[model samples]
Target: MSAARGPDVYVGLMSGTSTDGISAAAARFLPDGDVLGVELLGFVQQPYDASQRARLLAAMESGSARDYCMLGADLGGWLADAAAALLAESGVARADVRAVCSHGQTLWHEPGHSTWQAGESAVIAERLGVDVVSDFRVRDVAAGGQGAPLVPIADALLFAAPEHWRALQNLGGIGNVTVVPPSRGAVDPTAGVRAFDTGPGVAVIDAVARRVRPQLPYDVDGQLARAGTPVAAVVDALLAEPYFAAPPPKSTGRELFSAAYTARLIDDCRAARPTATDEDLVATAVSLTARSVADAYRRFLPEPVREVLLSGGGARNPVLVESIARELAARADAPAVRAFDAVFFDGEAKEAVAFALLGFLHVERRPGNVPGATGARGPRVLGKLTPAG
Candidate 1:
């Protein structure tokens, strides 16, 4: 269905698999009938306090019922605060905002079956004094589809260039790609979109970094990786993960590449090659991320991509960026791998902006899930809306 009207101003909050911080983006949508124009008014990151982050990480791996209940409320309040902080920082009036869309903190994601993102939308609504739209994945999953790569809906609506085929790659904890074709005369632009997790992005990298360098959040500028060497054997084995070859309309997150997963990988590397250093494991993780992305593109994208637009925290890492560019270059259908800046979009805040767009879609009563990306039976209006009291 077409968008009946623009959502005007709304705040979108995302706490990705990274579990580090919440990205709050204030976006204003200009009316365009069925296709709205997205304007990112402002973006602010609300980092989790160290103690909270540790608790959240624990809950993600395995947690008791009490822990889930408590953290869910706590995260909801955190998201509300994040949205408020974003509006204040951006100089947007709370009265002007239509809603706050929270992707919440994904605690467990089991693809086609069940997914859990802990954050109470009612709490966000009550605190923010704005409507809340959340729990976006369940509808898609209920329709016999993997509830993931939801950002492709944003890519198709906001970033599709009329000139070339572009792959909007998000190098978050898990690398995912939204391949958008050149907008061709409004014959259902989303029908051609292809999106899915490209595989490990920052997950393995960060896990190894935390083990080796507890003082740092991640490998700064990929220094550690640059100093180290990759074990191709390990990289190949990681690439062989069933998820990678499973085909599109697929999605993955920390569930598949948790800290324990990385530990297992390190153990396997040490078993096969006795002298694998911490740096080597880290570098191999980086390699695994880059190669997996390129491999997905080669196998799935039907059309030749003219450019690959990078986003997410991974974009900041020079080594990761260069590695991805190099991997793509080796492909027969090489495309220019460009930063989000190349397209004038702030890559780091892209996902946050994406959720804003999703909120806009929900406000307009338009379907947000791209069936092709999520393997859903059809497009579904994602998210549950909670009205402010």
Candidate 2:
């Protein structure tokens, strides 16, 4: 595939910190002057079975080098299968896709230090017979950035509001927010973009739910949380952690909000209220996610946001969404919080599509990272490519 050809059809794969499954999106991009238009051909989410989820979670917690080596190869095949499934669903031919952009599962991410995402690009290229783009974050991290919240560029180009600043909050295993200036703004569209991790998302809540009820994978639409009241004291204490106070251009993952951390949070919840039930613990975790997001906006957002577009798995949870809305309501000019799908395409497809955009940029020889968002020294084209055999 020559760079001059500029392939428009691409596939994006993302396995978030939630360690649940792979989200894949097949899209076609049309370049219209300065703006690029995206058509979502199809989207599919292939969930990891119980065994796959267990291995992934255990790898995140304490996998050895050999474990990572094998997991990376296995994950690539799984990712390839997902891409094939997406193409089959979208009715797109493999020969038509320009490249496959895989965010790969993030086994460990430590902002400003080092980040590692597994899934062998060679394996993907070999299996798919297409150029592969993987390891998109390391380049930004090498430039002294958080190497996270890389979706701001995509938000600015694809999802920015018409007139006001928009906050794109992703609720994966870890919560991250991107505040983007309007696409029609007078100044540089990306100049005002700022992003950072907002403490925990559903990671803690899911962990709590699974611990309390071994049979449950997650809160299941926040049912557990809605059934019980949040422990105010526990939420307050958790917010007081240094991470919430830390400023933007930062990132975090299971590294900070690990299973061990979740265990501690549950203990604190019980200690705060000896009579606290499992439902209460789950509610407290939800409250922490909601409060932490609102707090981050207050501390780091440079401009007032007119809207907050919620995405990822957490967006599907009404109790979590309602909690976020209530927390933001405390502000006199709180932004309207709504599902990303309501305003754009499917919420679950946002991240996958964002990665697809990144891959598009890579193929076009355009820089992918936004300096303001990632705190990188300057713009840099991310991802390493592996040509099809």
Candidate 3:
């Protein structure tokens, strides 16, 4: 297929595992030989209302076929709204947008077996009046790989550090890391990239926060965790789970750390220390996220990282960030940890921007998944296109 002929502008829509909201980014790509360069035009975050979030959580936990079917369409409309808002904010014309790429809300992700991302491309296409690319993980899973950490390709190509190995740790609902070699020199960008889910990001902490105070959606500013000490025993026992020890080319989701799991975690904390306060439980969850990330680095990373750039909702939590930095500080080769925004664009917009690049690749018929990161047998062009009528 010929390269897409139009303005280089593309919009990326993302609703991550956190189910917090839709993050939409409009960016312009400049292709330099085999490498692609991108400039962020604008970004918009459209949060799901209480009812919408509740419905989505229900679908994720245990929804009927009817729920899934309806939710997919509804989500598409929401994604379209996000895209429209982004374009409006960016002052980019609808016709100039070459395509809209969406990493639709992932409802079920059982790596190597099956994965489902709910959000109808047709709906996005019709609503946005632009070509839409959606469902990016199915191809990788079908190729006998963990269909996850798909943004590593973007990391390798677009976000690599100048002279050393860098780890792009996304603290979304689940923590996943993509370690990319430096972009300088004639090195193959994707050659050294490795990525996988470290474990729960802020999911457990958020669950505990809600349990502690019904109205609280999350432990805002990490005050709860900072005020309380982590139950070290609870953190250690939780990390002992087999997933943390498993080799890469692996992934996980709510299937393992569901609401029920959070409840059990609270029970474990209480059992370990009957006087454990709600803040302590929240602190333990934070510790679990921090320790698991450090453990993954020690056990799996192929190269010593020079820096770790954090992105996503968890990055906003100071206590979580400090915990991760502290966890890594003990290592002799500890790398500097900092928010992604300090070095690049807003951390919240990283995933959405990644999907925009993926969409650009799909339109160009180029492989998007990095074999090293996703453990796919080989590279493959991901997502299905839905042309606007």
Candidate 4:
């Protein structure tokens, strides 16, 4: 493959499984391709309207090809608007941006065979008058890998510690961990990074929380969860799910833990207990997340990792955070927990920034997918480019 010319500045647009909004980040890399020293120019969030979000979710749950095709462009417009918002806030002209990188909205991700991310890159390029790199997961999937936890390449590059083995775990709609072993005096720290999906992060919890608290989108700060006690049986029941037993180079999303599925779980919990409260369900969901992470570590972590650094929205919830800390504390090889924002970068913008790096690597003809993390055939430059025509 021929290398496209590198861009000095690019905008990364991302909307993960939550479908809450677009987290847009403008990033500029240094001359040496040293991702560790990136310049974050600006960040902005373009929230989706209630109808748009509902439609997007509907498309995911039950919609035709026509709905899928049309929604791509519609989402692309919103993603483009998010990029525009970032540029406007930064006073950066369209002509100045090298490209717009979008992770898009993932509709379905069936690893090793196919994964689909909605949002039309052509529409984004045409609307913004800038080149775009998107469909970031397909190439890795085609390479016989799960095509997820792709951010580990970025995590290893940006935050490899010299003396401490750090696990950069992201708690988005799902939880994924990238175990970056201490550099050990090597120039390339990526070789030691082991990554995979831990399990459902906020998806199951959010689904149950929304059911109990219809007025709120999610359990705010996990206050309800904090106030209640987790039912051990409910937590154990979820932990025994098949996904937790699966090994690394794996990934999952809303499809596995849909609204309908969670509703069933809530019913089962209530039927078994008879006196279950909303807070109890919420707390149990939190326990499930914590246990799943701990289980993944006990099952697959290649090296003895000492620190588990966190990123994404789940990092903001104290209830989830405390539960995770408690789980790790019980283990013999207890690792210290720290927020990504507290150490390296803003947790909320981490994924957006990652795609920014992917876009940067895309143009340079540099490989993006990590074999250790995604179980790909080998290193391959990911993403299809859409030129601003």
Candidate 5:
């Protein structure tokens, strides 16, 4: 794919864990920290129907090779429709767009070696008539890195400031934090950066909420969670998982924290109370998410971090936010865990934007994946592109 000239405008498409809808953003970027332009320009959420959401979730949980291919095509078609809607809503013609950078829905993400993100780029490209950059994580995994927390690459470029020590924590279906050190130039192309799946984000909470309420998309404002207390035994059992103890250069997904895991948790907690309320179960899950984050910060970050900026669906949950704030306050030099606010609440759009920026970097022959975060041997140009006919 040829790099577009003179502050190119790129469209980034992302559908995260929540599966609430597709998020698309148009960004005009430069190599330096300057963002020439940004437009939430085409923000439209196309939610999957109940059956479709079920199918996608099943395909994600456990499916045969054939099932994956079929689902991939379906997702691609759906994503294309979403793209068309977003463009129409924004009045941007397909030809006027430089390229589409997609973080195709992840079915299975095994960070140590391989990862999978569905939604065929061919379908997206053919439908949109623009080159598409997809399959970003595989290259990083092939290079012996955890093929995740890809946003740190963008964080290093756009958000990293020399004056302040910052942590960009994304609370999507899963939660991951990117710590940007005060020194910008210290990150070498060969040495990787620090990042990993902190733990469950809204993934667990949303899953359990759906099971309990069956009507609501989530425990809105964490109402159910806020009403109950955390089950200590359940939280302790969860923390014992080997994933938490493992060092940096790691990643995780619902594959590790799945519905079955939730069942086991429910069973465990229920054994103690025999009638553990749905609210309690949700509360325990919320505590698990927040406590795990605090623990990860204490264990991974060498120095005191000043701020934790949250994005993604979980940022909207008051109970989750309150729990995280309390956890952060306990430390002597604990940083403030705060929401990104509506203005910066690009949680819905951040991943998509990151991919767009990465696509631009790849187009420029510059490295995009963080070697340190992904555990790659060196910086690698991420993503494969299919040209528009």
Candidate 6:
């Protein structure tokens, strides 16, 4: 690989699993891959119209190549508008941005084999009149890795504590936690950082919500869940999911916990009780996210965790947050686990900030992935840059 000359201002655009909107952040870099300055300059949620969302969902549920191409172009246009809007709002010009690092919208993410997130870089470049660095996961997948927990590298470098073992938990459409151990021993107060995805964050919840109450886009802060009690049968069935039992070095997305899987759960719940309400289903789904996360920590990474720093859209839900805290508290030797100190600083824009940091690293020709986290063979350069042609 060739080294890259650093760019002064890089914009990172992210559309997480929630499919809620586009988040954009601006970041400048130093040679060491540290972000000199990162600001969530602006944000815009370009909602997918009913037809567009249905088409996207269908493509995700089925392997439709035509849908992939069509959605890619549509998404690229949406991204261009998002970038333009942000720049206009912030009074920054397109020419001022050195590059745009878009995480894009992940459609399918399979571990060692393949992962696809559509939104053509060339289209983004042409529409926005700026360079783009996208398809961020392919190189890592090619290197024989899970290629899913890419953000752990950013977490270790930008957020790791010297004297505390931290777990950065992101509860998006799918829940993933990065365990950054104390700089040392638990008692000695020093250990290096390590992180990975804990699995099944908001994926199950959102799926169940869409099915149980088509009238609602989500449970809305888990309000529906908070109104009902957890269902033991549903919880047990969810716990039996193969992904939960899988060891580390694994990654999954809509491919595993899709509408089909959610439908099955709904069927089972209905068979057991034909008159269950949406609240009951939402509560059960909430438990799935919380339990899976707690189980991963207890089963795989049992180190004494000092804090559970959270990000992503799921962190805003009071019901889910309380469940996670309660689960961690049950362990015999668990340390204190709290939400991110800067939790509300900008809930909508943190992932964009993360990608901004990644783009900075890419521009500096630095390895931005953690081997222990993403299960890669080793650190490698991420993102492919397209010049502003």
Each candidate's TM vs. the true structure? 0.96, 0.97, 0.97, 0.95, 0.92, 0.90
Candidate 5: regions farther than 4 A off: 1-7, 31-40, 183-193, 342-345
For model 3, residues 1-389, the per-residue Cα lDDT tens digits are: 99867667889999987888999999988865445677999999999999999999999879888888899899999999999988888899998998999999888898878999999999999888899988999998888778898999889888887788899999999999998877777357788788899999988889898999788889999999998888899888888899999999788888888999899889999999999998998998899899999999889985879999999999999999999999999889989998999999999999999999999989999888988777889999998999898
Tens digits of lDDT, candidate 6, 1-389: 88764446777788877776778776554433322324445555556667766766777777566767888998888877777777777766676688888888888887878888888888899988888988888888888888778877666655666576678888887778777754432341112445556666787787788776788877787888998777768778778888888888777788777877788777777777677777877887888788888899888886667777877778888899898889888888665655564743465566776777777778779776777766778778888887778
lDDT of 4 at 206: 83
Clashing pairs in 1: none
Name the TM-score of candidate 2: 0.97
Mind sharing the TM-score for model 1? 0.96
Worst 10 residues of 5 by lDDT: 31-40
Which parts of model 3 have CA positions greater than 4 angstroms off? Answer: 1-5, 32-34
Instruction: After the best TM-score superposition of candidate 1, give how far the Cα of residue 325 lies from its true spot, in angstroms.
Output: 0.8
Ranking by TM-score: 3, 2, 1, 4, 5, 6
Tens-digit lDDT track of model 2 for 109-131? 88878999999999999998999
Error of 6 at 299 (Å): 0.8
Clashing pairs in 5: 145-374, 146-374, 192-371, 192-372, 193-372, 193-373, 312-347
- With a 3 Å backbone cut-off (N, CA, C), the pairs that clash in candidate 3 are none
The sequence of per-residue lDDT tens digits that candidate 1 reaches over residues 1-389 is 99665336878899988777999999887755335577889999988888989988999778899999998998999999999888889998888888898999888898879989889998999897889999998999999889998999888888887878889999988899998988757678796898999888898888888888889888988989988889888888878889899878788888889878988878887887798887887788788888898889888887878999999999998989999999889878789988997786678788988888888889889999999889999988899999998
Predictions ranked by lDDT, top down?
3, 2, 1, 4, 5, 6
Error of 5 at 360 (Å): 1.3
Q: In model 1, which runs have C-alpha deviations exceeding 4 angstroms?
A: 1-7, 32-34
